[model samples]
Target: MQITPDGNIVFILPAGPLGSLPISATIVNTWIVMTILVVGGRLITLGMGPAAPASRWHLALEILIEQIRKQIQDVGGGDPGRYLPFIGTLFLFILASNVLGVVPGFTSPTGSLSTAAALAICVLVAVPFYGIADQGLLGYLRHYLRPTPLMAPLNVLGEISRTVALAIRLYGNVMSGTVIVAILLSIAPLIFPILLQLLGLLTGVVQAYIFAVLAMVYIAAAQGDEPGAA
Candidate 1:
């Protein structure tokens, strides 16, 4: 594994005679996470009938979905159902990416600026999409010029800054955790480093939660307090 300038560890797959794709750890791990989530989601839904036995996976998924909805409601986003898919997807994908870092030969895609930025960009694009969808283009644009048109430039800048902040925050925290653990392993007792890694796993969940919460807040702000926007 080679560390990139951004501090992400990456593995370059060997090229094939037939021009094989060059894959990195981030891409491979992300695909793995996505596949697992997809299959798990299918399995969880398979026994939805009341006559079917409830399993631990279904119970956990229920708790997660309920919590996501609760958080959305608490934010005054109204009718959490509409926002559930977007917010829930963000949390699950991020949660999976972060939590899976504990596996051997694995590093979180969130540790890469590329992946973090891509997720942030999704939120960035989603803001205006939801805003326009709820408030109409003219209505949404009007918010930027509120108080006066002179503030429009600053409002625009704030949106861009938010996206940057989201990307850096996720990338920095995950990257630092990986780095610190690596450093400790070299100089500290073996078991101590392992303990720290387990702690890092919890930290990963916290980071994912924070990112998801912030993204939801941003979306709600963009959507204003429209009852239907939720």
Candidate 2:
């Protein structure tokens, strides 16, 4: 992946296997990683007792729990506990999937538009549904119309655009990383790609964080938090 001065992004990877299904390598790898994350996270958390986290697994789970809890509190303010479950699950799932992608021959699901779009859609739908449910339809609409009448339509448009932009941003970042590394390796199978691979690792983690953080921000904004709330 190449980063441009104007903040443009580029990703490269092998041409996806062409067929009726169009299920590319990245898609398959993403599904596998996400499946493991879901199943593993469930098993790990399930083993934890209700009391203070005693075991190593429980302790790690507690740290993740605290992180999500803190993010919700920071963004959603009063009674944000209601959003804890959804936000927490999303953060952990994405974090796990992303880290798993750094493994050799694996690709970040967030690198694919399909995966990112699915996640973005979930956030987009959840935000407004939760907003109206919590604040009432009238109040929710009012929030959109606030500060000015004309800005309401624009604000709503921005909300929709935000979801689309979020998906593209992540997809571009990860896919581009994969492409650049492939190109470097093709040029010369040497120590250079090792450094690039490390860069890929960092990129994966950062992109995951950005996606998770933005998901919370979008939800918070819809719930009437100030702009840049998350």
Q: Highest lDDT, which number?
A: 1
What would the per-residue lDDT of candidate 2 be over residues 1-230, giving only the tens digit for each residue? 43211122223344557523334555566568668977887887785667755778878877877877776667666565777777766666666666766577556666667777888888888888888987899888888887898898898898889989987887788778777877888898787688887887777777766776777777777777764444
What are the candidates' C-alpha RMSDs? Answer: 3.4, 6.4
Clashes of each: 0, 3
Mind sharing the TM-score for model 1? 0.88
Model 1 regions lying over 4 Å from their true place: 1-21, 226-230
Alpha carbon lDDT of each predicted model: 0.83, 0.72
TM-score of each: 0.88, 0.80
* TM-score computed on alpha carbons, candidate 2: 0.80
The true-versus-predicted C-alpha distance at residue 115 of model 2, in Å, is 1.3
